[model samples]
Target: MSLVPDILLTGAGAFILVSLVIVFRVVRGPTMQDRVIAVNAIGTNIVVVLALVAAATGNRAALDIAIVYALLNFLMSIAISKFTVERGGVL
Candidate 1:
């Protein structure tokens, strides 16, 4: 049992914990913005996990996916904001 694997596993566990918290917020928050924030946080955490897994496994494809995810997150956020404003602030 090396410390490296333990550290990696700990990182993953932390990701899971944060993801759970975000999910809870997304599900129970009274405001749409709160849910959006939680969703964005989840996307960020997913990108981080993708990068970590890529580094640990020496997989190049994971890095590409992470990059795509990052771009998609940004685009989605922008689109959502525009839609919200156009919809007169309703979700």
Candidate 2:
């Protein structure tokens, strides 16, 4: 029998659904900044999903991976933002 909590499953499912909605923004954003923000949101959602999975499965290793992924996501957003801001000195 599985011991995973329902709340964790629900949270993960919700985040996945939100991420799917964000995909439309990533594909159809009116500006580069908007697309970048959507990508960042998707990355953040993935991190949350990882954390929820770790909590449900009692896998401490997944939590460590989530931390690393979060750091990379933050760095990626900053780098993309800088790139967009400096393209011809404006995006």
Candidate 3:
């Protein structure tokens, strides 16, 4: 077995573990902000996983998708902030 595959597998495993923890927080969080944070974390982890998978499979389209995901994440954050402000900081 090569070290590259081993490293990739380890990285993927770690990303999954962290994603599960974020999932737990998203499910059991007491506050909306906590859940939002978890969701954002999940998105970030998804991007990371996709990038790794793209690298492993030698597919460049995955990189494009990852970039789009990052942009979406940024847009979501901005929209959330705008919504919260419009809602008088209650959201």
Candidate 4:
């Protein structure tokens, strides 16, 4: 109906597509660091998607959940890096 909704939906779709491509990179990465980076990129895309959904649906709760998810993603990345370092660069 409205152009704004169509635009947001398109953006969400694009984000999903990008995330899928990143997933492929994660699965086929030659190195652990590359996989970790791909995973992080996926997480970022997920956050953007969540925000888009929240805006499209006018749901404040979704925004809050997205914030929490983002924090968790950041912590996970840090933990992965620490683990890799402790394991002598082998993940």
Candidate 5:
């Protein structure tokens, strides 16, 4: 049997903590822009977590999935921002 390295696990744990804290901002942001940025931050955090997991497990496929999710996250943020701007940019 094998164990994942401690540092990778620790880094992933830290990012998870940060994502959890950002969830509050997503839930109660005063404006649409704030919420969008928070959501984007969460998305980025998850990708980092996924990459860390992949490294710890020696599975490259998960890293590819993380990259794909990151691209989607970027596109989604742009789309939502555009939609909000078109509607006068407020929640």
Candidate 6:
């Protein structure tokens, strides 16, 4: 029963809670850009959670997945922005 694991779990839980709030914003966003930003934030939170889990479990694979996920999230944000611009602000 180490305190380190408990702290890591708490951190992950906090990240998840914040991500959930971001999800609500994404769902209820008044504009497309707002939703996009919220989605990006959620992705970031998820990445942090993955990193924490990797640290807690000493699993390198989780960190690798987090890296790949972060790349995909970045690409998706760019694509969404481009699409928004091309479509004249329609999501």
Highest TM-score scorer: 6
Model 1 per-residue lDDT tens digits across residues 1-91 = 4466557657966997889878999999887777788888899988988887776666899889999999999888888877777988874
**What's the TM-score of each model vs. the native?**
0.86, 0.89, 0.82, 0.92, 0.90, 0.94
- 20-64, model 5: which lDDT tens digit per residue? 999999999999899999999999999999999899988999999
Better of 5 and 6 by lDDT: 6
lDDT of 4: 0.91
Candidate 4 lDDT, 15-88, residue by residue in tens: 99999988988999998899999999999999999899898888999899999999999999999999999989
TM-score of 5: 0.90
Error of 5 at 80 (Å): 0.3
Candidate 4 wrong stretches, greater than 4 Å: none
> How many pairs in model 4 have backbone atoms within 3 A of each other, for residues 3 or more apart or on separate chains, i.e. clashes?
0
Q: Please, what is the whole-model Cα lDDT of each candidate in the order they appear?
A: 0.83, 0.91, 0.82, 0.91, 0.93, 0.94
| lDDT by residue (tens digit), candidate 6, 59-79 | 999999999999999999999
Off by over 4 Å in 5: 1-4
Candidate 6 — which residues are off by over 4 angstroms?
A: none
Instruction: Look at candidate 4 and tell me the lDDT of residue 53.
Output: 87
What is the lDDT, from 0 to 100, of the residue 2 in candidate 5? 52
Weakest ten-residue segment in model 5 by summed lDDT: 1-10
Against the true structure, what is every candidate's RMSD?
2.2, 1.9, 2.1, 1.7, 2.1, 1.8
**Native-to-model Cα distance after best TM-score fit, residue 40 in candidate 5, in Å:** 0.4
